[model samples]
Target: MHSGMTDVTFQLRYGSNLTYECSLAADRVVASHLPPPALTDLPARLSEALAAPLEFPALHQAIVPGDNVTIVLERDTPQAGALLAAVWKEIASRGVAPDHLTVLQPASYRSQPPTDPRDALPADVREHVTWKVHEPATEVECAYLASTAAGERIYLAREAVEADFVLTVGELAFDTLLGYRGTSSSLYPGLSTAEALRRSHGQGHDELSPDDQRPLRELTDEIHWLLGGQFSLQVIAADGQNVSAVVAGQADAVLRHGKKLLAETWRFEVPARPELVLVAVEADAGGHHWSQVAAALDAARHIVARDGRIVLLSELEEEATDGILMIRDARTPRDALQPLRQAAPADLIAATQLARTIDWANVYLLSRQDHDLVEDLFMIPLEDENEVDRILDGDEPCAVIGGGQHTLTHLQNR
Candidate 1:
């Protein structure tokens, strides 16, 4: 789109305020996707969004006195403590006793000690709010919900099942399994029984496009509807540590608005398929990891030419997950993925997407990981920007994707 310029400069980011820059011939650049500016006053916007929700009553009006409310909190959400504090303060102000309000944490956080969102609240408010982590394996912690039309039995976290009102606070972003993740995405496998979790997420090859109708997503929606409480609050991420917008309303309405806002904020369309794609991944709170890299590669693979090159740029330092390790130790990707089809581990989806992408295209990595580890995973290790510059110097069309983990990039025709 640069009519006159011969080259365009790109400043890729990772970690807080860290950046890497390179220039490409203007004609060679086919697409560039970047996150929108972060919201300046999140608290004020949150207050306003909660006050006037879409297709639903205000949060305060929806609750009555003596109601036992459960707030399902997404632990990784940006400024989660503040979001939880705001929601809890509103519920408390409406005469709901602190003891009657429960904060239900996801099961994935059980391995590590998670920070208490109550810490962000005022001293008096923080003292009385009850918090419980979801235990899917314990029969006492889960209660029978309804069976699906397909005869699948469902069990939800006892806290949500027993609560008079349920409020889900989560983020809206692209998912490897579900097209768009938010709303009830956290409730199904997140708060359900271990069997349900495995059944829902154990698929190794059920990747869905953002616009496709995914059975997993449909099932999650059914769970949300069956659970009864409709109030939902979802945030659209702006970058690593900030959100661009917060949508609160009926579950369906909030999901619709959130999806629309997400596309407007993160979608990028290229005129045609490109031969080279450079993706930058990062998270400010904790360093980067493999899941983010996998998501970025998935997005890149969508609009990349056959046998194209995808270079993942990050400062990733975490050790590879069990699924990734399985890939490294196996003779072939299919051989490694066979076990995941039966038992979905924490990084199953990420590992599957990564292995598939490695098969589809050439994947290069620039991270803190050891060169041997990167090679074992079948990715070329990128030494420096000089290497990236050398690749860009080639005469093929290329693309740049920022916040690639959160971005959704595709061709205009497809």
Candidate 2:
């Protein structure tokens, strides 16, 4: 695909508030993909979605005067605080007292520390709302749900299980484990017991298919059913902190709507495998981490040629995990990955993905970490845009992918 210009300049997003610009030969560019323009009035769109949700009652109609409500949030989602504020205001307007509403969130939405979702609320509203982070390892924090089809016992956060109404707020995007991230995903493995969480971590969907019938998604739906979760709010994000769309209402309806919008916004098709795939992983507020980098690399690997080069640009600063440390100390990638296959840890997928990506292509990572740590992972450390400029100076076919963490690239001839 020709970029239609002699020299194409790209202002790529990096870190929280920085952008790195570079130029590429238009003829050498095989493809370029970016998210659609962000919505100009996000708050109004959110309010409209809540007021007229699909296949479910509006917020005022859904909640009664005395119902105890719990909002389960996927805290790492872009603009999560905005979503929470919109939902909370609608529910509170229905005469539901502040004490009866609780915000239950996962301990760590990403590899880095999370900003409290409730912080988006006004000071008065923030003071009255109850908030707690889910702790998967603590027995006291969980309540027994039903058993799965396999008869494996299921446990979720006590707050979510016991609430009279549960409203799930999560991001809708392609996922390695769940095919596509559904509303229920944030509640089950995210808020479930440590055992369930570990089991979920072990089930990596290497096939990368978006079929709705995948086992993990089925499990998530079943868990949502067991919890009597009927209403949900899901967001599809644009590049960086921008949100492209928001869907609200009945779980299935929201999932259906979200899936369609996700495909239109994030999926891309290339003509052929490029020799070099340049990708940018953006997290607006300092939340960029190793897991997102892994996701971006995984996306790039699908569209790059054998022994091709993948340059990943991010502002990753999260500390190394135990799995990462294992990789750092191992003699070979296989040795580092062998132990992870038995027991799933926090960084199981990330560690394995990084090792596999390096084995397939040369990965250049530009991040805030030290050169020693970058070398430890067998990745070449990228210091500045000069290195990027040097790489682009090659005449090989290249593809530039924006928001690679949420992107799904397919070769047209494949």
Model 1 whole-model lDDT (C-alpha atoms) = 0.81
lDDT of 1 by residue, 35-147 (tens): 77789998888888888999988898999998999998875677887788778767777889887888887776223445777788778867788887788888888999898
lDDT of 1 at 104: 87
**lDDT by residue for model 2 (186-293), tens:** 887888877777666753667656873677788888889988999999888887888888899999999988888977899888998999999988884326777778
Local error of candidate 1 at residue 30 (angstroms): 0.5
Clashing pairs in 2: none
| Candidate 1 segments exceeding 4 Å error | 1-4, 109-113, 203-207, 284-287
Against the correct fold, how does model 2 do in TM-score? 0.93
RMSD to native, candidate 1: 2.3
TM-score of each: 0.93, 0.93
Q: Quick one: best TM-score, which candidate?
A: 2
